[model samples]
Target chain A: MTENRDSIAEIDLLAYADGRLAGDPVRRAAVERHLARDREAARLVADIEAQNAQIRALYDRVLDAPIPERHRDALWGNAERGGGAWMRLAASVALFALAAAGGAAVGYHARDGIDVPSSLIERAATITPAEAGDATFALASTGRERVAGETVNLSFAMPDLSAFGYRLVARGHPDPGAPNLVRFLYRGVEGKEVSLFMRPRMDPGEERVSTRTVGDVAVSYWSAGPVAVAMRTDDPQMDGIAVAKVLKHAVDFARVSVPGPLDEAAPLDGTGAQMAVEAEAGTMLTDIHAGPSQLQ
Target chain B: MNDDVKWMVERQIPHLRRYALALTRNLDQADDLVQDTLERALKKRHLWRRTGSLRSWLFRILYRTYVDNRRRWRPERMAADPALIDAFASQPPDQEHRVEYTNIAHALDQLPDEQREIVLLTAVEGMAYDEIADVLSIPIGTVRSRLSRGREALRRFRSHTEGAAPLRRVK
Candidate 1:
């Protein structure tokens, strides 16, 4: 305990007071013993620590304040004006989309231990077989949506995966208790199925795309503005990144049609749709492919 | 900038903003200072040596920006808005914390800018002596001396004003 007792210096007092010496117990104990007999040094150390705590208490909360969106825009500057802002935006959205997918996996309550609403799984299991055809019907869960105490009409078109060789064969709310929850069952060749789930998030979150395997089902999820979408497909060979890219673009495009307060609360500026389209058309398109590997 | 670079810069904004606020004391001014810092950092992104940390690089940019711009503005030292402070507090602070906040805010404002910067980087930001030296472009010896003087001055100010109401601007 008295190992470094003689090595304590004026500088060590400050270090000990600021907790820089915390990892070095011998030095810390030496400083403590120095403080035991040296009342003035002890008072100085106490005051220094007190000052640190007070300063931190006064200002640390600024960290919790969401970075002002304009700064986010500024950091990723405007791409069309010759900066890669949209790509940065897309990259960020892709990052969060992946995060939300993980959260959805947990919320979904998947058989591999990623749990979602079991009722949705049950409904997907019990869904009646559709008559044969390549039909793409859009099912929208539209209503006067209330967010943060104000009613706003929120509508975003469900992704059409027809290009991916899948056609919407059925549409309805899988969870009746959650009327806002709508599911579109898409049937591809060989009876392959991809169910797209749509719901309005309670608050607008950053846009992102992430995927998780729910039992045999692969769930690709993304959220933009107030709407969250999860594309669940059981086909192992399915190009999920391509489907997610399509879903993300469709959802971002639909935000252009969502005219009202919802856009105001969105992470992007009022020109979010334009930005989203630019992001889709730009480097982010390529960037999204690189996302799943980096994120997973 | 690349997405990777942009994200790296983006992550450091809050810390930059915190240091800027500590330096300037006014929110709008702090934000403006940080905005300038980010602009400069982006413009000179090539200057950042990958050998060093992004946090230290950003802090270096921020400190230099503060030094370069200090002469252009009139002394408009205002207390952080009480309501802003109230919002920042996790729970409502009692009368004692309010007094403590006022005392330290006043004491901090009174320090020479050099000492104050070192004190804050050391105490508030929890930067090491060498990191402080790197950020300020000073020697480790200078960092220690300035920090010692700064904390001692704060302690002296507190002792002299014990049991007294610290003066606050009425904004």
Candidate 2:
């Protein structure tokens, strides 16, 4: 009889850990009462919770990655049409621009509008990369006292992804709607647009690259040293992490190439920069197994 | 396919892709698996009943597709790296948390395919036992037993590596 009760208790313990017993307050309290006396069962519950967190930490970013272009094309039938598709693409881009520009004000009007667009803008600004689109222009416009006197150039030069068949199309400075954000738009060979929103990193320690999908667009955001960037791309073919590696490698190289005036102005955040470089190298090593090189 | 079904199927793509990636751990293969699943689902759209959960139906198709092509898509599995765990462990408590966060991927990769699928569907996909049973076409009792066994395996794996003694197994 004792063994039978214990067997049922064990199952209840598993159900309790999974919140299966939540709907039944009587059973939940009973399980809680049992857990208070059972140290091993308590530890088991904690382990399950920790394991769940770890599993999510590992794979939840997949939700943020853009759906593969093949899948999107397969479903939407966009890949079937050639010339007509390009016209539609152009129209969509025009529509997006108009909506973004006009909706900038709408974000301020309604608190709920802060979700997709405004939050993207806010996040870009808050994590804005130090260097805007142009390295030279960023240095000069940032003010001589701040740039030459006290701050490292820490310019995040945009990678020339022409190697990957993407060309820079439009660059937007922080407008009234989106403050302290720099937006870079890149057009892919297949008429897909990849937009990168960048801001300065306020926290040096937060360097994990995270991806989020808002509606049809995928946003990959990470901070490296003084600058932070979020690459928002709707191009189904775009691999967010690979492109981030390219950007990180470019920024690391830029840091090495910059002249001494900026170097002496401020002490470099060696740790963050080193971590970024190491991460970039680690990713490059893994890229060997990532199948064909997107870089032609 | 009709627009409504297409829209419903499209909404479930991310969930399907996430599950596929968890199963394969290779991006290219996961995407291929997803592509195949989508194609199969489209072809069989006529059989899908409107009353059933589309998410469960889509998952069932994806799971079946993965099982059918498992051998072809199975990449070389990675063993858990103790040195990596040590590096994370040597840090402060916060870094120890990093060990917990990062090492689980390796541990998960080491789990048996059946256990890994059950664990992922439960933890990552947030599927209920009945739903999981439906998706996998297993009995509800099997779902409960598999989930318990999977969680126990994960707990033991973590506890063993961290040098902590795990509780005695009830089963």
Candidate 3:
């Protein structure tokens, strides 16, 4: 609005400050000349640029943070789970389930006294091989436990922890009442426990993979589509995030749909206690055994 | 579904994530937005027209998904997410200026959702006015005015918060 040709409007000056006026050299030059003479105007532009820098510095690194693996697996994984007529219905139900589950879990835990993380861990730790007999029908054991409305895959392939020299240890008996939570435990060379818990989420709202330490145990949790998965370990050095991602990727897409375990599919719900020792012929067995610390 | 579309969508993910981060201001929320956007785009990949810029198309989907979710989780929550802000606020010791940096996060957070979206699209993603209009399905004039008001609002916020308690980083 300034009559003087050299003077700049606030909008034009701001645009110029943001490098948005690059296509208009004449106007930009006028603003530059005005700022050159008016230290006040130059200071405004500098302040504006500084804000821009702060905003960029705050967030741009996310672009560099390795894309969380579950996200990547959703895009590229070969085994697809949720594309059925059931999936469309399950998608809405999953969302509803998520919110309902959260509310129910809070109320249920308050009333029935189900400790979410600990009970899950403790129960998994207590279940005997005979108790985990459901893993025998590896997939069926999980599939059979589904609630009437639950249609998503409830079981996941045991993550090939062989890369870290860990072997299948046991499958925990999910509380019959809260049958959604499936636990697969693995053990390292020294018998350290690493448990992967996979549950088909009814909650549509589960998004981020979060990690926390319960006592000395490190727990990492995230959701992929209809499934929510978490991996827990006592090993402090295991990048819980990376391992959680691996498990999430497996839980979401690489679920072993056809029967047949790594060695022999747990006979419909008579799954063995120590699976690594029972690993069937042709089951993958990685020779490179390293502690969780060597995951990198 | 086709390889080219797949590759292009994959490449735009970083840019989408960056812009989403600027809008959501929470890493978890931002990544979730990107993931949701990608899922939708892939599911409806057949609807994609080869005419306009792929970036614009992807951004359009992303913005729509974000708006839909925000509506579902209505009453916009611009709560101070220290987890995200502190990541950047952990910069320098120039006490006087650190105040402005802190205000920067507050200012962006406080901006109305539309203004925040318009401002970040222009400032972070460097979208042209027309491109923004295309992304948000608004006129170019609305884009220009919203952006102008957004910048002024930010400046006002910084000034108002000046000399307040020293901003601190949390983890």
Candidate 4:
């Protein structure tokens, strides 16, 4: 335990104990001879080994324990759904669409008589799925989203949702007033669509999170630091509150820039089309630098 | 991407699960962490291509996810009480190792996360100093320092305190 030259350093003794002393035989023998004289060093090595044995004894059983059903499904369920390669590719594409479209839509929704940045995830009154049919979450045909004759870049911050049994499907803009708004949609294992609506915070405020269920659609909304996001899904097992908590730190603010104005909205496939209504949220993000009342 | 690499990943699940269980001490949460790591690793499988050690890469992701969850929800750890020291390698040991296991698990939970992880990787997984460095993304000297600190902290439970049974004398 002493630091002196002849006195073996603790780490050297530990290395000797861990059997990493093979690097130098002379040093290893010297350390062993040192241990023969030093009772403390020998005892210390034994205790360290004992601790290791005890830990292995405690948790190594998990090596033989049954893998969980959900994880198993995620790993090998590719055949039933699709190949893992195809699903992963689809996941990346879903991420890109959410980044662009979901941003423009949420920004516009928060600016309209809505107290954004804080309560953006709490209040849900006017927007409904009944009106969601007409909005075309259209591809601008140029590979970039265009808003009002100017091409806009939308970036969405989304965490990988595969572990939670979800994948990205499509995006939509569900507002009668704002055609430029965008919303990204996700499909659960059961083919139910989970809509994610996001808008960048114009005036950064304290983070807020809240969950509510309307018409069997569980919605979780949270605004943290730079952006506000809302996600709604119909899966009975989908715990909106839990998902929102994870997402509060998980989602990144989508970046929206206007090279042009809004064009189209898309419809998502679901179970019997029990559409979950979320605000058209992407357009007003450009207004973050446009100052207060800019989007109005 | 290929079958061989896919199989290699699948084989590490049980080992990953064990390390995770030791970290969280909860079966469900540990498995959830494992699930998340596997999904993310597979999704980003290309990144793992050039790494010299797959286990190190996988474990790095595991602990990273564990700490992320810890930031959101840190399950309260039992404070290390120097008063209630117990022997880990019992005298006249039984087959189950029940008493020794509980005492050590409790002792381990008391150490700080950084130290606990270093100790567990070194002790439980039998990882060498270099592998510990890779797993933690820390310098080897730092790993040694943390290990020394952790061992001294944990040794109190085994080396000190007056308890029911006497520790078997080690030569």
Candidate 5:
């Protein structure tokens, strides 16, 4: 039983039985010798050979047997349906259109009831108000600097509300201290998005807030009454304090709603249609931001 | 519709079905497994960007699906029907003696699922050790070891059965 034990590795014997070791002459010869000397090993080889023969018999007939019509039909059906390629392409186009529309709508709504420059809407979209309630006193400011012959619009949004409410969606459970605080992020011009969020905190009778800068982005936060405010700005050229001041003003405007001489009511042709379009645009933008493009 | 792909699918189905039948030992279950494997391959065709052989990918899906279903069912103690075994054994012996082959099949049914898979893939499917490794996502050494163990077990089972019934071999 042990005559050629050292000469034949079990793995080599298996490989030899499988016919994979046919090209390896040394191992093959060793296994053959071991098989000759050992009855158990020879039986093992015979069993394997028999099993192989039986399997061939079982399946060799299938080569001549007609392929079931169902399988062929399904494959053809898939091919006729464009094999999911066209569907994916259509989804991608729909997603891109949605993202563009969503971005524009969010920019416009965020600009409403504020006296910010129209050119600064793109920058305002990236602004994150520091302190919870600071969003109530918001403003937009833009600084353009020529970078390699291209003018880059650096904009910021300042919200004055120290106490504000927002939702948080994260891959993991949110921290207890950051309850009711949510982060907002937006992809910007350079293929990079700014990250910022707000959490409500209490400070004395009068609600006041503070701001801090993390990496290239600035985070400002405050707690006022029941509201909390936090704004993030990644623009290097714009001052976080200046943006905070504008946000405070916007918050005050949201609270008091003081009517100005230029504040005239405009007639709406179809407010429902406008809202639906805006909603659809938002959905599309969300899809695009979450699609394969972002993953790539 | 690539004619080559169509032709390949048409040709491979019978082989795939036969392999499925051997694995499941039931026609309906085998067809269901084959269908599921094909559906998955079609959905994830992007993963098959001609990196390796298509047959390997298909077999991998089939093997994984079978394993998953087995795990879900957990029919560990279910015994093969003695009547079915006898029926298979009583079939006319080929020139090489069919009784031995039926004993092998019965022994294979008794093997542990992992060992049985190794036997079927290597012996039944005629896959190389490396191909078995790829299909099972195991090291080649593991495949070899499992095959050896499976073969040894089957041989022992056959020898024991033959010793018990000497007259069974006469007819």
Candidate 6:
């Protein structure tokens, strides 16, 4: 009996029992043939039927109960708000305090032409990398000044990279919904102010690295080195090469360990590879790195 | 979003509660489980994607919540009262045999939680094997095997209990 039982595919019997198997006439017939002769199998089938009957009798009443109204109301309530306003205000205040503390720490570095502290560089590194898509990275000077009718305050210790022909600028907020935007404001020669906004170029099978004009600002934009760096400035004469030179120098100064060329770097994981493919597909470089913690 | 979903949920709540009652054997707990499942469904409505039947999704939530709650809190078992059994026996056979139903319930209670779930989802709820698979996140093959084993266990239990007791007279 056991030897003959080996011929019966248990899954087919189960599926036949559950009524899920379809279009496989051969296997279905095989199971039916075995069931016809086997008394124990017949008994097993009866038992299953009885159990099913019992279960149906037990739970058929649940279908008639009323759905509570509160459940639907809660769903809409939770979904619409991005985050509470109080939380956002608290975060802004906390950020200001952190900036003040950071500025005091980096005050000596700016006064004396010494290397910026490692902590300051690391703090700046926390800002999304420019190659990572539309996000801004800024290293604000400890000095405060009014800009565009708003009193802009700086807190981070600025690196004196004037020798490299790149000046650190007053940090400004990036435009919401910009695919790739980075703002770094700095006082250039003769106290002239400049802001760098770099946005990555759109490309296929590769993340875009490009430059374009935004209003009066000449932006140097590129998607290379796993970040999108955008240097935006009001200077009409400033071109891509000059902006790129300044960005490269500033990023080099800020980056603790520069990554090697793309080919040498480890391949991206499944999610990262998917984002890279999307980037190559010319989908506007959406912020892919924002995970659950950044939901607010 | 459709009237069909609203209609289905409205029509199916009683059945869901009855099944949940059978599963939990506690009226309050059963209702709580049903409520929790509905709340979860409402929150995750965006993920519905209109791919599968809504009942399967609802059942999946109910099953998972029941399993999780069982793990978190030990259920309080109600002892079978001899007087209640006597009263059930005094009732006419033509009436739904409360004693027999209680016997079946007791037998179901003895089965492992996983086996009991398979039994309830398949036998009681009239869910397709594919629907059960989707609800439980198990393969169809596993569902079949589990269902077979669960039925066999139930049969043995019912038979053993039946053989031990000749029809006792009501006091």
Show model 2 residue runs off by greater than 4 Å. Answer: A1-8, A79-296, B79-98, B165-171
By lDDT, the better pick of 2 and 5 is: 2
Second chain TM-score for model 3: 0.81
Name the lDDT of candidate 1.
0.58
What are the lDDT figures for the candidates, one per model?
Answer: 0.58, 0.55, 0.54, 0.54, 0.45, 0.45
DockQ of each: 0.17, 0.18, 0.09, 0.14, 0.12, 0.12
Off by over 4 Å in 4: A5-7, A22-24, A79-296, B76-96, B161-171
TM-score on alpha carbons, each prediction: 0.51, 0.49, 0.48, 0.48, 0.46, 0.43
User: What digit string (tens of lDDT, one per residue) describes model 5 on residues A13-104?
Assistant: 56666665432344566777788788867665555555566545443444565666677766676455222432232211110111121211
Fnat per model, in the order given?
0.39, 0.31, 0.22, 0.32, 0.27, 0.27
Top candidate on DockQ is: 2
Which is the better candidate, 4 or 5, if ranked by TM-score? 4
lDDT of 3 by residue, B1-171 (tens): 644345446657778888877776566777788888888888987776544556788899999998889854233344244544555343432544444545677788788888988988876775667879989999987887888788778877776776554222221
- lDDT tens digits, residue span A132-190, model 4: 43323443333433223444444434543443445555445555344334455665444
**Candidate with more favorable, higher lDDT: 1 or 4:** 1
Instruction: Say which prediction, candidate 1 or candidate 6, comes out ahead on DockQ.
Output: 1
Q: Best lDDT goes to which candidate?
A: 1
Summarize candidate 5's per-residue lDDT along B1-171 as a digit string, tens digits: 343344444445665776776677655677788888787777776676444445677888888888888754343331244333333332444644555555656677788878888788775565667767888899987876777777778767877877854322222
What lDDT tens digits, residue by residue, belong to model 4 across residues B27-136?
Answer: 56778889988887778777764324566778888888888788542544521222211221223235334455556767787788889998888766666688789878
Model 1 lDDT tens row, A55-90: 777778778778876677778766433224433332
RMSD (Cα, Å) for all candidates, in order, is: 16.9, 14.5, 23.0, 21.8, 27.1, 25.3
Per-model i-RMS = 12.3, 12.4, 13.0, 11.7, 16.0, 19.0
Range of the 10 consecutive residues with the lowest summed lDDT in candidate 2 chain A: A99-108
Name every residue pair that clashes in candidate 2. A127-A199, A128-A198, A128-A199, A128-A200, A129-A199
Q: Regarding lDDT, does 1 or 5 come out ahead?
A: 1
